[model samples]
Target: MNAHPQPAEDGANAEHATPSGPPPARLLRLPEVINRVGLRRSAIYQRMSEGRFPKSRSLGPKCTVWVEEEIDAWIRGIADRGG
Candidate 1:
């Protein structure tokens, strides 16, 4: 056996690597969303109710998360609108 095994050659581990394209979508929990958007829990929910925020997906009965890209787009929208 080689004392020091060499790293795999290029493409040898391609199957284990993520495919090239857009990165995986990230899910942000309520607290993280709050921190990112500077909105309180109530305000976040309020905006969601009014269709002014990105809708969250329920992971379970009591867990919810927002798509990071959607939230980022919302923020960018606000900036673009000069808010």
Candidate 2:
């Protein structure tokens, strides 16, 4: 070990440094999306089937996530339309 020890990393943002401009959008798990939009699992699936919600992306054989920006856009649209 070096004589000078580096400070402990801030766990809150240990993944990456703060970004300039708009922060990069990340993939959100189903529960994360539900929590953000306050929708039930079945409702999200129903809306997606009706082509009114963002589609989930397959990450692997059994994993999927939604683009956070897409969900945010959906919410913004609802607000814009006074709904």
Candidate 3:
């Protein structure tokens, strides 16, 4: 009997493994953004109110998301400003 687990026969495991290059760009939900930026929802709203953070766009009747590129740009701006 094999002691080690075998990979999926169809390469599913390999396909799902994390890539080495840059992450794929895609809109993230508010909670995900909050976790990534280490800020509470209230603080996010505060920054949006002050025009310091990118605003979210409606994705559905009750859904919203932030543009991946915009968030990346904002992060770059902060890094450039030494924040």
The candidate that wins on TM-score is 1
> Model 2, residue 3: what's the lDDT?
64
RMSD of candidate 1 to true structure, Å: 3.7
Put down candidate 1 lDDT per residue, 1-83, tens digits, no spaces.
Answer: 75644544674554465566999999999999988999899999999999999999999999999999999999999999999
Q: Comparing 2 and 3 by lDDT, which wins?
A: 2
TM-score against truth, every candidate? 0.78, 0.71, 0.65
Computed on alpha carbons, the lDDT of every model, listed in order, comes to 0.90, 0.88, 0.85
Candidate 3 global Cα RMSD:
6.6
Order of models, best TM-score first:
1, 2, 3
Model 3 ranges off by over 4 Å: 1-25
Clashes within 3 Å, all models in order: 0, 0, 0
Over 4 Å off, model 1: 1-18
Could you tell me which residue pairs clash in candidate 2?
none
Model 3 weakest 10-residue run by lDDT: 10-19
